[model samples]
Target: MPRSIATLLFLSVLAGATPVLAQPGGTPMQLPRTISVPGSGSVTGTPDKAQVRLTVQKTNPSMEKARAEAVVVVQRFLALTKKLGIPEAKVRTTSAMVNPEYRWDQPTSRQVLVGYSVQREFEVEVNDLDKLGALVEGAVDAGVNHVAPPVLDSTKRRELNRQALAAAARDAEANARAIADTLGVKLGSLRELTAGGAEPPRPPMPMAMMKATMAEAADAGGAATYTPGSLTFDATVNASFDIVSP
Candidate 1:
C-alpha cells in the first residue's frame, strides 16, 4: 500500500475499536495488578575478632642470603604468636615472593641486577579483640616490617545476619501492606522475594582504633592504642506480591 493509504487505514482501525485507558500524557499503558517493594534492616554489635596481615622483607646481595634471613624472621614471628598465647592454627603464610632488584645504569643505559629481595606475608585471625593492639605492636617489634590496617570482625556474624534478614522481611511485608491499603486492595500471595548484601561493607568503615602502620610503626616508642568499635550489619530484600480485590 502507498504511505498515505496505509496511514489512513491505521487511523480508521483505531476509530472502530474502544480506546483502552491511557496514563497521563496520552501514553497507552496496561498491566496486571502487582506491587514490588524494597526494604532494608540493620543490626549493631561490637567486633570481637581481628584479621591482620603482617609482612617481612629482606634484601641481600645473594638470593640465598635474602631467603634464609626472611625464613628466620618469619619463624620468630610465629614463635612470638605462640608466646602470646595465640594458637598456631590461627596463623598461616599467605604469600612468598622473590624479586630481583634492578638499578638503572646510566653509563650502559640499561637496567642492572643489584640484589635479590625476599618477602613473606602472613594472615592472622585473632579471636581476642582486646589483645589486638598489643599483637600488632609485638608482631612489628618481632620482625614484621609491613602491616596492613587490621580488619575488625565479630564472632556473631551468623547471628547478626539472621537478625538483619528477619528485620528486612518484616520491613518488606509492611511496605506491601501499606501499598495494598492505599490502592484499596488486599495483599495476596507473595510472587517473588530476594535478599542480598555484602558480608561487610568494602573498605570497611573506619573504626576508632585504625592507625597508620608503615615501616615507621615499629620504631614508635610506645604501643599504639586500639579501640574495637561497634558496627551495624545491614541487609536488603526485594519482594513482589499480587494485588487482589479487597
Candidate 2:
C-alpha cells in the first residue's frame, strides 16, 4: 500500500545571468543572451477513484498447510469482492509471500523451525465511494488481517496536469516580463522551455488518523466510516527567452 509520490519537484531556473569565462584558447567566450525564470502552479480537487488494499496472512506447523490455509482466505476475499459487485478487472493480487517461522531454543542455545507463514495482498479499485466503508468491513470479515488506509485518485489526471502546466508557463512569462521591465529592456520571444512531473506527492498516514479509524472499526464491526478527501496537484516550468531591443 505504499504510494510513490513525487515531492513537488519544481524546475530549477537560472535567476539572472552569469558571464562566460575564458574559452579553451584563452579567448573571451560569448554567453547566450537569454532570460530564465522558475515558476509553479497548483490545483485542488476531489479524486474520482478509491484504492483499497488488504492482506491475508496464515501460519501453520507445515509450509503446505500454511499455503493451503492462505489460499482459502484469499479465495474467500476474492469471492466477497464478486459478491459486492466489484468488477473482476478492478481486483488483483498485488503480492504473495512465504516465511519460515523460528523459535529460540534456550536449552540448545539455537534457533529452531516452528512453523511457516503465508501472506497475500490484494488491490481493489472501488469506483463507488458510498460502498467504501462497507467494502472494508466485508473484506476484513472474510479473513483479511491487514487493511491499508484507502487511497483516492482522479481519472482526469492528465487534464488537471495540463492545466497546472499552462498556469506555470504563464507564471514564468509574467516573471520574465517583470525582470525585463525593471532592466529597461523590451520583452522578447521564448527561445526554449523545459519542465515535467506535475503531480504533488502526499505525506504518509498520520498516527492520530490511524488510531481514530481503528477505533471506529472496532466499534462498528470492523467497518470504519471513511471520507474521501481532495488531492492537490502542482506543476512547474523553466523558460528562457531571447533578449530583444525595443
Candidate 3:
C-alpha cells in the first residue's frame, strides 16, 4: 500500500510563453503550450469469491501402493467438491506424479531407498465466499495434507478496474487545470491522453494465520470462520491539456 497519493504536474512552458524555433527556409515554428500531468486512483471493495490449492500425498514401501493411495485420496476430494455444488471445471488437477524416496546412511556412506511417494495437486475455485471455510475443512478431513493460502477476489473486478481508471483520468484533468491557473493561462481542449492499466490487488495472508485456521478446522469439525477482506485496484493516467490563453 502507498503511504501518500498525489498527481505530478509537468508544464510545457512555465512562463506561459511558447518557444519558437527556426525551421527550414527561415520559417519560425512555435511549440505547443500544454500542461501534462500524471494521476493515480484506487478503489476498494469486499471480495465475494475465493480459490484454494490442495494436495494429497502418500508414501509406501511399494510404488504401486503409494500411487494407489494417492489416487483414492484425490478421488475423495473430487467427490467432496462435487457434493458441495462446485462445478467440475472449477476443480482441476494441477499435477500428479510419483517419485522414489531416499535416505542417506552415514555409516554406509550410501543412499538407501526408503519408499515411494505419490502426490497430486488440485486447484478449486469457490464462488460462494461463505462456503470457503467449510470447503477447506472438508478437504483437510478428506486426506488433503498440503493446502495453500486461499486467495480472495471479487466478481466485479473488471468493472471496478474501469471505475478506477475513470477516477484517474478525472484527477489528471484536475491537476492540469490547477497548474494552468497557477501559470495564468486559460485551459483548452484535451490535446493527448494515455492510460495505464489497473493492477490486481493481492490479499495479505500470513503463514501463521493459515496454520491457525487449519488448527481450528481440525478441532471444530464444522465450517471454520473466515473473513473476506477488502481488495483495492489501482490505476494511473497521463493527460495533456492545450493552453488556450495567457
C-alpha local distance difference test of each model:
0.76, 0.76, 0.82
Best by lDDT: 3
Instruction: Summarize candidate 2's per-residue lDDT along 1-246 as a digit string, tens digits.
Output: 112211111111133333344679899764556778987877876776788888899999999999998888888888888887889999988998999999999999999999999999899998887677677767777788888877778787788888888888999999999987777666679999898744655332443675587578887666655666777889999998876743
| Candidate 1 local lDDT, residue 200 | 54
Residue 227, model 1: lDDT of 59
Candidate 1 C-alpha RMSD relative to the actual structure = 8.2
What lDDT does candidate 2 reach at residue 198? Answer: 47
Stretches of candidate 2 exceeding 4 Å from the true structure: 1-32, 202-223
**Candidate whose TM-score is highest:** 3
Q: lDDT (0-100) at residue 173 of candidate 1?
A: 91
lDDT of 2 at 59: 95
Number of clashing pairs per prediction, in order? 0, 0, 0
Query: Which window of 10 residues has the lowest lDDT sum in candidate 1?
Result: 12-21
Residue 76, model 2: lDDT of 83
TM-score of each: 0.76, 0.77, 0.88
